[model samples]
Target chain A: MLESIMHWWEKKQYRIAPYLFISPFYILFAIFMVYPICFGIYLSLHEWSGIGEMAYVGLENYLNLFKDGDFYLAFSNTLWYMGASLIVNLVFSLILAVLLNSALVKCKKLFRTIYFIPIVTSVVAAAIVFTLFYDRDYGLFNLLFVAMGGKPLDWLGDTSLSKFAVIGLIAWRWVGFNMVYFLAGLQSIPKSLYEAALVDGANSLQCFLKITIPLLRPVILFVMVTTLIGSIQIFDEPYVLTGGGPADSSMSVVIYLFRTGMEYLNLGYAAAIGFVLFGMTFVLSWIQLNLMGAFERKE
Target chain B: MKRTLLLILVALMIMVVVGSSGAGAQEEVTISMWTHDNLYVEFFTRRGEEWAALHPEYKMNFKFTQIPYDQLWPKILTTLAAGTGVPDLIGIEISAFSRFMKGDIAEQALVDLTPLIGEEKEKFLRWEPYMHNGKIYGVESALCPVVFYYRKTAFDEVGVSTPMETWEEFTQAGSKLKEKDRYIAAIESSGDTPHHFLALYYQQDGAIFNSKGELMAEDDPRAIQALQFLQEGVREGILWPTSSYFDAPHFAALKEGRVVGNYMADWWSVYYQKPQLPEQAGEWRIQLLPAWEEGGRRSSTAGGTGFAITKYSKNPELVFDFLHYTYMTKENQIKRFLELQYFPTMIEAITDPQITEFSDPYYGDQKVGKVFSEAALQIPVQWQSPYWSEAIQILYKEAITPVVADKKTPEQGLKDAISKIRALMK
Candidate 1:
């Protein structure tokens, strides 16, 4: 029996060894990712309170989501955050990356490390600090504004400004993260291209517009897609900073889902919310990738 | 052959000695507990040592894990749902208790403590929040009576007296404080549940739900009145609107004397007030919350926690005995009050001299326990509903913020909150 088993193993080793070596990833992906997605779908079709029996109420949770005003508010707030952060973070990081990649810059590594510190910093700690910075009366922002002959504005108390307050925290934490990617992209672009453009009598702005942007398309596309996905799932900043408050003006989709599932124990409804979020993320990402010509065949 | 027989005799003798020793030894039992508050763990650890000293025949091994507030409930709920790896005891917050009692799972997950409580129920003050269908599942850790904490110097500076008797006088004092460029109290308009509102509403005998767990806030005039009082205070510039309670910014306002008074539970003093504002220790005082009317109830309950035995516990009776000895007994109840400064729920402990005569230099030698115990007896029952978490979220968004921010009238806001909460119930 031992000789036969050894002979069979030797015969199949080439074909089976690779799969045997790579089985861990597939096993984990199926257990953690695929199982949860399938279970979430199953859970979305019922009414459950986490511990009790799940009662089937097909399509009701979905139908209710359409009419849920709080869901719409949370959806719109999440979009506002995504749109604002994408614009602010992308522009700011791009500028920093361009500056840092320049030959005239001093201590480039030091500046890069300093900028990247926020990314590695604990978000909860950063949020606590930012909360103090956004305080209505005693915050640094308000104090500076008042010193500059302006009135102290309620940065977090007013519903109109609470979203911006949370967005400010998001931008602070993420701009550096995106900048590192842009910096790599900027460095990867050959200096010879810019030299050629300057030799052709193009001004600096023209060279930047003509050579730099076109070469950075792939990086830009990558950053935009990742940023959009991250923004859609934003929870920590708003949760720790504003708590989705001032009348839910800063509420993100994930925060609402968390409150529903964890706080309210409406697990089935929360699952429905989760599916809706997944759908939104999928459709938006696809649109983004398509618009960027990611799937287009090159000639 | 003789040597082999001698070795066998020696092994038999050793076996007999070991068996006799094992028979004389005490059985060991391990009990695992999970709590959100480290203070509870500290309190119980000391009590557990005392318990071990008294009961020597059984060796008690306790395993206590203190989890953060946000993570603990989800962990406990998931464990309960999976029907495995449950702790022997769980400390449940008052607001989260409804989640545990949502379905028949409560019956399956928690041991019915009613039989354990038995005749001692009459001695306890607040049990409504932990009850479902006439069964008690948790023993409350504190009475949590909401009291008005004020800066005595601020009031004296404004020529307003301490311990105003009615809401009318409280508002009158607010105007006087406003004249001095100070606010009477800081009311939270964002990032908090309607705890202050609920305290006042409960003071006027208002409830979000009746005994049947039906929606009653819309029709309850007291709810509207309570909200209107807060709105009027803010509009008149008597009350400052803070984002959250017991946070840094709120404490800053207190320190700067921008805000002077706070209506919060007794636990706030020990956890927040004294620790945060240590410099202003002797300048503060505690009083029964001013009545809405001259003769209304002076106190209402806001926040609480309770400990319950899980059905998964191997020794439910032993756990109950431990709880009864530590929490339900008069001596330990007063001891808890003296140590934690949480007002006792036991009627006997509330009046105990150890509690009633206790004074604190932080409040200028005020008998803090006496004031709290007085409020403890008058604490109105707060009904529980499965929709409680959702209802409070709606109440804050639809009613508390809009009404206090002057975006909507009290009645309109209450109407909106009611409709939203009702829709949730459906």
Candidate 2:
């Protein structure tokens, strides 16, 4: 084996072949990906605005994290949003997917495209469109509410309702994509199982629970894990809509971190906040996997 | 060999012909100017036409962009950071000049215009704010000192006299209008809102960020007191509660004579209120802000941009010429400001007969020139540091607006803002 390895190394053609083939990825990755990430981490260790001399602060930035109450508020809000989106978006998507899967449904592709249109649309554009719908006095929703004798709400202004407004936006934008996943999962289930359930005097609900859900477990787990990650990183909608305002009531961890790093120029504290967010997400994902028996299913 | 020789001979002849043609031709230089709005394009084009008539050898190309105010600074900073493909001339906000000074990008990017100042220095009376380390880096386009424009009808109804001098009297008079179901003022607490909070802070002898770039006003008693004053209005339901600036409600309310007063720089007069309200004309009059203390300052300057030549400019002399022609000349500056309502920084134009004699139909025949000039002279010159933008955001977000909304206690809010400022300063 040693002699063959030595002979292979001696082969100039083979030696140059692998290097030439793989060099592009390594070179590009080093320059684009690895360098910036490492530089960002390094930047987090110092006190430098986008301009000026950087002062070496050691671990003071990380220490300041414990005292930063805004971080805690943002972190807690992130968890709250994740929980809300997971439950509401998942249930809505699952129910919609089931409804569309029924034989009673017509124009399947057209409906699918219509439902999927918002998901494909840019978040900035979608947020602007939703802003018009959520406007206070003259908005469509408020007009309808007023016609029904209900008072209009300051949708983006009131602290109590601001988070829900953002969650509503996120759910509306995302539920269709989740439904597509659920629909695909439902389609993969063989119709024979449902037919058998029907022959056994089982109702539609019974068939859904006993047969459809068990087989679609893998897809369900996939969606949950991805959604968990996505929800934790929520930024654009809240940033564009409320600007984390009405007194930072709707600020997310990513937005807070962005403010610290970019706007405030406190990269070190921002990095610490970033690490804390990373740890929380990682632990939560692990808990989810274990609780859902995801590992056991895969094994 | 013969065919190759013949080809070489033909190429040599072609090269000789091209060289002779190029030698006699003047070298045409194209200068790229990055500006915010296309509003200035016609002005610059008109100036370019004048410049070409004087000097036929050079061509000037203008590139104007209207980036969102929030986006413009960061984009410019990033381009400056990369040290490539930047415009030959750029405009920097007076409020944001300090931030650019702190960054290595602008230090190398800007041309030192000190030598160019000469007698033209008098053209800009408020030049100290845009200067750093005794070197002028930028030239002011407009003198944007803030003034109050009140509804004459509302004031008359409320029985308030012209030019209320003290904050107490101003607040008292504005409060009476509330009984008649009118807003005392349109309080804009929106994101990146500019009410010249820095000027207010300065008038009360408060500073946002100190020389060391640490937040100075966070723990200061005066800052908290200033915030509480605005909060009182909200609690009393005298000020508009919404966060948007000049939103539909604000506009509609003002149009219907429900808004008692509004505060903005001269730009608002030209760009918004005057141009939009032709029928409601002549019911508005301008005055300086009410003083906090009896002997305290009244006017605060808010927003303006200065033109600067980038180091990459090929013809720095020609760039200076354009700046002089548009900015320094009294005739051109006065024409532009009078036509555009930009409020020229030129001292000569401040008291020009054309300006003083002119009566705005929108302001009900009230003379605006004297009011603006008095306000401009009364403006408190504050240092525009690089950290001013960060300080403004913190002060507004954590202290001013939050206090106004009753979300945080004044002291607590200031503490949070100061602590954030301290962390940022590090």
Residue-by-residue lDDT tens digits, candidate 1, B162-206: 799999999999999999999988888876567879999999888
lDDT of each: 0.90, 0.75
Give per-model CA RMSD. Answer: 2.0, 4.6
| Each model's DockQ score | 0.77, 0.32
RMSD of 1: 2.0
Worst 10 residues of 1 chain A by lDDT: A46-55
TM-score of every candidate: 0.96, 0.85
lDDT at A30 for candidate 2? 98
Clashing pairs in 2: B98-B385, B98-B386, B99-B386, B282-B362, B282-B364
Candidate 1 docking: what grade?
Answer: medium
Q: Per-prediction TM-score of chain B? A: 0.96, 0.86
TM-score of predicted structure 1, chain A: 0.95
Candidate 2 docks at the CAPRI level of acceptable
